[model samples]
Target: MDKIIESFIEDFKTEFNYEKIDKSKLFEHYVNYVLISKIYPDRSSLDKINVGGTRNPGIDGLAIMTNNHLVTSQEEVDYFIQDADLLDVEFNFIQSKTSESFDMGDIMTFIASVKEFYKDGELLFEDDLLNLRDLKNYIYKNSIKMEKSPSLKLYYATTGKWLGDINLTTIINSGIQDLKSLDLFSDVKFIPVDGDKLKSLYREIKNKITKEIIFEKHTILPKMDKVTESYLGILPVTELVKVTSDDDGELIKTIFYDNVRDFQGFNKVNTGIKTTIERKNANDKFVLLNNGITIVAKTLNKVGSAFKISEFQIVNGCQTSHVLHHMKTSLEPSIFVPLKLIVTTDDDTINDIIRATNSQTEVKNEAFEILKPFHKKLEEFYLTFEKDVNKRLYYERRSRQYFGAKAKSEKIIGLSTQIASYIAMFLNEPQSTQRYFGELLNSYSNRLFLDNHSLFPYYTSGLAINVIEELFRENKLNYTSKKFKYHLLLMFRIQVAGAKVPINISGNKDNEKYCTKIMEALWDRENALKIFKSLELKLESVLAETKVLNRQAYLTRAFTEELLPTISNAKKEGKLIYYNFQKGFGFIKVNNSEDETFVHYTELSKVKINEIVPGLELLFDIFQSPKGAQAKNIEKKDIVKKSI
Candidate 1:
């Protein structure tokens, strides 16, 4: 391997904690992450893109993109269909090899697998691949909703250099033609990535973005507080396209503001924009007919007619930019677009500009919620733990914030993930986290992300979810644990602190102490694994007792209601370590204590007395009696026995 590529892999392994994964599999993940970062820089989970395991055939990584969001399940596709219009779709397939050179045979196998994946009633995949296939099928089934044909992108990466052999070129060209003949995709591209190319792509994602554009034809505006500079002008269509596109001519997706709605495809408005630019004489009228684009930048340097801008976002005009980029080749040089550029590092001014400029479109109020001071404070809170490696976490209040900080991609917690974890652990509403973002925000708007809420609990919840995901990646937990991960967060809290949840964790020393305990447990890997193991045992006991085998049932409040009491009892009132049925007396082990209490048959009801058995967990209170400590207020915990 090239020295640069080797160095990148080592960094990748450390950042994602992938030392345990096989070498070949690690390379596949590295390739997938580096390449996909080109299009979607804000991917929250790397495991979702990896589909290369047993029975996967030849493909190593696959990502199905609807609009700009990465879709991993059918439910996500359904969400897009019901909530937002599916304007476009793109399929990204990757096949990586750790070998020094790529072989023709391996290349052909990859091509064949791609074909089989598109065919009906053919080879089936498991786990992530199966979910990707289902999403593909569902997207095609609802193809009518799309304004354009889905695109197909195939990437073959190897550790060796590409010398441009004639035979290999011919083989790749043949594969591209064969895929295009299917008529399923409007365009098909097969990119061969060598070690050198991979290294460059890695640098591209980690590098700070800077672009220069000619801004001569502009009028300067007086800047106010928090505004460095402002400009109102018209940019030529050609110049704007250069700013919106990359070297490969793909849209610069990361430049768009995170809060603004994504491009609405070739809807009535976008179609009009495209049509106006495509017309012979009407092109020059574009500036008058279209709404101007709004740009906000952190730093802007001026040199004559040329301006170098870095760390910029297109706060408005997402639809116009997409349309212009699509019709760039056909646009005339006489065409121009309205442009409003503002330079500011103040987040409040940026959010104010975004909300004001986006009034023409219907953006949900929740979109701007992250821009508030509460989330900003949370982001700052996460930074205070940076000195401790194990306790450090990045809160991503803005899109690509972690990328800008060069933080480990896996260690950065997204806003959505943070909210879900807090709802599950602190709020005890794991089921509600699965609901759509809009509904969840509206339903819990008042209670969540509050200024007065304790920040420790939020960080604790985020860390708990992070630990659960790591456990899954390490195979310490089985597949069944994935569905109930949120539920496990609740159980983890219950095990550390009993069922009585704190009404307001802020300004309460006891609650702070409780959160600190959870943080310590999560910081240590072995201890965290032990806690999850015990929680899983209790989970299995509940499933067996309720006879609820349906996977979806685990997400319901009823299932949680059933599982909570059982686990809480074991935590509040410990196991029955010893029981002498004939003697009518036994010893009970108290939770979080070193001593045991005496239990008598007289404390149990008639029904409970008949069901009494050794090793069964029971909920009871201890009281001082003549003999010392005795068990009272005994109740049964619906949990299986642990051997004494």
Candidate 2:
């Protein structure tokens, strides 16, 4: 146990002993505070004592899932998730029994509460505890959104291990399925944070996940300068993916803690990486064509061919790794990417390496100032917005250069244009965002900044922050988890998409209108949730038959595979839906209708001949062939379009 955690526990006990306040509330407070300060940076949770007493609807605390940028697409949503929509508010239905030990019956009681939440929905919260009545109203206020059940996350936090020998993991999963059978929620992710895990989290609150990395002595290259120890080496694609993308994704995120950037929505840069690794002549010329990864680690150890890293972050090569990971079906076991790993504890050096490697590479990365369009518009909006002192939102194109902030402006919040691009592009099209997000500084990234959707940095920041704050402030959400914040964002995406007819928001409009409907509705706290809700029956039918998972689920492809057709069906719009390489042809199942079309490999471009294997998503036009409607001009979806 960490001494800090022990001290916190002692102080908590002492405070409750001196005061007449409930000890359980103090325990809940301790857990909530640790979760906010440690797991979520720049986030806080409302305590049970602060919110409600016995009526607290089975929830102990309320946490805003802020750090979530783009996560999984497991839950079915009406629209694609956007950057701002990514922050989900979750209710922690806490069953914190701070006693020495707990049994199966106690676990069942917690599960039963979760079951009741699903059964009664908001109506149950009418007389329920923890200020949840407000939350219940928020859910029904937008009938369209309420049509679909809210996602519920059940958390059982305890100070003691289970006394019964029953397998809690199995029991929890069974309970989740049971709730599913009851149709209590759109989805339920049950987490039982055992005593050991709870202690681990408590210990982690004080000391973050920083550890020493060791590289085999022979594999590391000598450092050029005494300023720091840097190494150049090679590691198989397997190791790289394993190190960067942990199963649930928390581990890899910890590695990139300082970068303060999430992987851009998937795009061609990442897609090209897929094509590069899957190409026939990869090992021969990949080293020359591709720039190697730039990584930072705390320690390095090199013992023969063995290499171990306590912690590391890839400053560059995010696309390469992401693509290599997603396209692993086509990966070669022996192929390698050149790696340059720097071992340093200095924050300045780490940032320096990131700036240098990103700027000095063959594809030089541009600064956030490139978000001039967004910056300009925001400045204009604020000219008038400033009059409303409480409502003004300042957009910062550069990092910490806002003269207003220098003057200590009360409403100033730093908005890196880089982050704005992330928000705007992601909200516009999740598919395009995924294919292109990582290359924001590259020329290819300009696709995200096209004149179609004018940048609104103030909107970029205001839309997201305000909506998230309102959702939490008004108790409109179900559950919040740092691990599942991505869930909330998905729900928000539906709200924004609901604001405008989906078609008008498309590129069909010569001048695209950035989604302001959700923002406007959110600003006024109107019936925002109605957007996706009314479409539930329609969406359920579509999602039931849909075949692609959105780009967000790519990180956990293995699990996503369990939920097949993992990405957006928008791109696979008119193209070949499914392919069979053995027959050199495939079928395109047009959504809604049971119509199928035939496509042959010969009909598509031969450029990706070898890469044209089964399950390679493609786009094509129908041409008149003797074999009936023939698929022609077929192109792989991941390939970037060249100038005519």
Task: List candidate 2 segments past 4 Å from native.
Answer: 1-23, 33-53, 62-94, 103-106, 112-153, 167-174, 182-188, 208-226, 241-252, 264-292, 298-313, 317-335, 358-644
At residue 153, candidate 2 shows an lDDT of: 63
Number of backbone collisions per candidate? 0, 47
Error of 2 at 231 (Å): 1.3
Model 1 over residues 548-600: C-alpha lDDT tens digits?
Answer: 54444554666766676666453347777888888878888887889788888
Model 1 clashing-pair count: 0
Every model's TM-score: 0.81, 0.43
lDDT string for model 2 (1-644, tens) is 34444566665444223133455666666665554433333221232223323544345644322123221121212121233232233334556656655556766767776566544434433222412433333433333533245566666667666444557666777788887897535678766655666666655543334433333322545665533566676656666666665433443444443343344434445556666676777765666667877777666665555555544567677657656666665666566777787777664465567666676433323332333454555455645555553355564433222431322222344443234333332332222222222333342444344445444433543545444434443444432321112223333444454212222222443223434544554455445444323323333343355454322222232222222222222323344566676777777654354656677666675436666544556565433222344454456665634522
Instruction: State, as a TM-score between 0 and 1, how close model 1 is to the true structure.
Output: 0.81
**Which prediction has the highest TM-score against the true structure?**
1
Q: Least accurate stretch of 10 residues (summed lDDT) in model 1?
A: 635-644
